[model samples]
Target: MQALLHKIIEQPELHAYWLNTLSMMENVGAKKIKKCEHPIFVNEVILKHASEEARHAFYLKKQIQKIRKDACPTYEWQYLLAPKSSYAYLNQLDIDVCRYLKSKHELKHERLKYAAYLLVTYAIEVRADELYPIYQDVLRAYKSPVSVRNIIAEEQNHLEEMEKQLKAFSSEWEEMCRVVREIESKLHSVWIENLHQELGLS
Candidate 1:
C-alpha cells in the first residue's frame, strides 16, 4: 500500500497542478464519508477509503514525478484549492442538490435518496474517473503519446468498485435516503461533531 505512493510519484505524465488536485480529492472523499450519520459503518467506509485514496495519491504522485523529476511537489493541506479540477464538481453537485431540495416542497424520500447517490456517483466519482483518457483521446486525435492511455485504463477500476457498491445497495436507495434524512435531521450536530473530531479541525 505504501509503495503505491512511489508509483504515483514516478508517473511523468501527470502535471503538478493535477497532482495537487488529487491530494485535495483524497481529503474530500474522506471528509464526505466522515459526515455520514452511521458511525460504525461510516468509520469502516472512511478507513478503507483513506487507504485507497492514499494509494491513489501515491500513484498520482508518481505520475507527477514522471512528468517533472526535478520539480519540488507542493503539499498544501487545503481540499478545495483547485476549483476547476475534478473535485470542484463534487462541491458544485452539493450546492446544486441543496438548491434543488430547497425549491421542492416535499421530495419523495426515494427520489431524494437516489438523487443523493446519483449526485455523488455521477457528479463526483464518475467525473473524476472520466478525466483519464479524455486527456489522451485529444492527444491521440492530435497524435500525442499513447502511453498515458494505459494509466487511464488502470484508473478505471476504482470507478468500477464504486459502481459495484452502488449496484449492491441501490435497491434500498429510497429507504436509505429516508433513513439518511431522518438520521441527519435528528442528529445533525452529532455528524458535525464527528467531522470535527475525525478531521481534527478545531
Candidate 2:
C-alpha cells in the first residue's frame, strides 16, 4: 500500500489530486471535532482541527486557482471554487461516537498497527501540509506562479498545529499500531475481494 501511495505520488497531477482529496478529508475531520462534547481536552483538539481544516481548504483552493488563473487570466476565483462531493462524505463521517466505535473495532484485532497506521497517516498529512513550497516550485518549474502565498503560509501553520495536537493523542500509540496492522490486512483482503467480485474477476 505504501508502494502504491509512492506510485501515486510520482505523478504530479495525481499527487496534487490526492492531496486535494486529503485536504477535503481533513476538512471533514475538523467538522467532526466541532461536534464533540467530551472534555476540555477534546474541545481543544476540535478547535485546532477546525482551524487546520480551514487552512487545508484554503491551500487546496489556491493550488487550483493558480492553475486556473494561469490558463485563464480572466478567471474569477469563485469559478475555481466549484463544489466537491467529498465534502458530503466528510459530513457523513462526522467524527462522532459511531465513527469512533468503527475505528475502534477496525483496530480491535491488531491495536499497535492501527496506532502506527494513524501516526503514519498524520505524518503524511503534516508532510503534505509542508509541501506547499514544493507545489510552488512545481508551478514555477512550469513558469506559472499564480498561487497566493498567504494560503500556503496558513497551511504551514496548520501543519505545525496539527502535529502538536496529534502528539498529544499518542499515548495509545503502541496499542493502536498493533491493532491497525491486523485490521488493515483484513480490510485489504476484503477490499480486494470486493473489487474482484464487482469486476467478475473471481
lDDT of 2 by residue, 36-96 (tens): 4244434454465567666766565456444343322222322211223334333422223
Residue 169 error, candidate 1, Å: 4.5
TM-score of every model versus the real structure: 0.48, 0.42
User: Please, what's the RMSD in Å of model 1?
Assistant: 12.4
* Model 1 spans > 4 angstroms off: 1-14, 42-50, 70-72, 75-88, 98-118, 136-155, 167-202
TM-score of 1: 0.48
Q: In model 1, where is the ten-residue run with the lowest total lDDT?
A: 1-10
- TM accuracy, model 2: 0.42
Give the Cα lDDT of each candidate.
0.46, 0.45
- Per-residue accuracy of model 1 over 22-105 as CA lDDT, tens digit each: 555655654554443243334343355546656655565565554566443555424212333344444545555555544542
lDDT of 1: 0.46
